[model samples]
Structures are given as structure tokens and as C-alpha cells.
Target: MGKYDPLGGYLRRLKTDSVDLGFAEIERILGAMLPKSAQRPQWWANQIDPQGRHVQTRAWREAGYDAFPEAGAERVRFVRRQV
Candidate 1:
């Protein structure tokens, strides 16, 4: 499993349609520090690379959520995607 799979499972199990989490909270769930690129909003975008390199994005997307990073708040809001 990929490192971010843990996060996917966590999100998938949530009953709420939305969750707001700090970066530190995510690291706690991941047990690994996010990359420096994570500071950029683009890093949390719901897009993917052609080679499937964006594993983190895949994690949330697979869990039926979309991540939206707060501007300069060091937080992210995950909204469950509509079917």
C-alpha cells in the first residue's frame, strides 16, 4: 500500500460529508511529514499526473472526497464528492 493509503482509509470511514484538518493532523495520520511542496495549494489539488505519481490525490479521490486547501491557514477542508 502507498504511504497515503492510511489517510484514504481514514477519510473513507468518516460519516461526515466534510472534515477540516490541519497539516499536523494529516502528518499524524500519515506518520510521515508532508513534503515541502505541500505548503503550496497546488500540491493539494485534485488532479493527477499521467504516470500516477500523485498518490496523495488518488487517496482522497478514491475515498470520494475532494481536498481544498485554505489560503495561508495551514488547513485543508475535505468535502465528499457527489455521486
Candidate 2:
């Protein structure tokens, strides 16, 4: 399984249009620590690199969600992407 596959699985199970979770909570779901890059907003952007380096993006996007980090907060709000 991919490192972020568990996160994808988690998001796929949610029924809400949006879900908010702390960094710690996400770490728990990931069973791994997020990279320091996670502190930046761009890390949560929906775009991905050509090398597919941003596995986390594949996770949420495939699950039909997008992550929005609350500035100055340790939490992120994942909104279901509009189809």
C-alpha cells in the first residue's frame, strides 16, 4: 500500500461535505508523520507534480476532497470537491 493510502481510505469513508481535523489526527490516520512542508499552504494544494511526488494529493483528490488549511491553526478543513 502507498504511504498515504490509509488517508485515502479514511476520506473515502466520510459522508460529510467537509471534515475538519487536526494535524495530529491526520498523522494518526497516516500512521506516519507529515513532512515539514505540511506547514505551508502550498503543500495542501490540489495540484500535483509531474513525478507524482505529492502522494497526499492523490489521496484526497481520489477520494473526492480538497484540503484547506486554516491559517495560524493546526487544523485543516477538507471539503468535498465539487464534481
Candidate 3:
């Protein structure tokens, strides 16, 4: 499990094609404000740790979801993978 496992667990409990949540909602799950880097696209990319494991991306992928930021919006949209 990674530090962001809470986000993954929340995503797993959702049953929908997509969900749009405000930064506040995400912070609620994270129990803290998002880092400034989180607003950057690179932060969402699959980053590898020194142990050769994906950090943030592992959470969503494990929950069968992917998150994308809406252009000019303050919310993030998480989409479920098509089976």
C-alpha cells in the first residue's frame, strides 16, 4: 500500500462510469490539502519509486479507475475502466 491508498479505497467503493469531485472532496479523502505539485499534470503521471514500484498511479489502477483534471476547472474526474 502507498501513502495515497485512501484515494484508491474511495474509488473502489464507487460504482459509476465517472465521478467529478472538487479539490475539497479529494482533500477530505486525503485528510490534507493537496500539494502544489498535484495541480501539475506530471504529478498525475505514473512515477516510479526507488523500489521500482509505481507510487500514486498504483492506487487508482488497483481500483480500476483513472483520474483526469478538467480543463479550466477546479475538479478532478475519475473514470472507471471498461471491461
Please report how far candidate 3 places residue 3 from its true position, in Å: 2.3
Q: Choose 2 or 3, whichever is better by TM-score.
A: 2
TM-score on alpha carbons, each prediction: 0.95, 0.93, 0.79
Identify the candidate with maximal lDDT. Answer: 1
* Ten residues in sequence with the least summed lDDT for candidate 2: 47-56
Write the residue-wise lDDT of candidate 2 on 9-71 in tens digits. 999999999999999999999999999899998889888666998878998989999899988
Q: Model 1: per-residue lDDT, tens digit, 1-83?
A: 89999899999999999999999999999999999889999999898677887879999999999999999988999999999
Evaluated at residue 18, the lDDT of candidate 1 is 99
Model 1: weakest 10-residue lDDT segment is 47-56
Candidate 3 lDDT tens digits, 1-83: 55778999999998787889887898899787877777776666544456745477777777888778765566788888787
Ranking by lDDT: 1, 2, 3
The root-mean-square deviation over C-alpha atoms between each candidate and the true structure, in angstroms, is 0.8, 0.9, 2.6
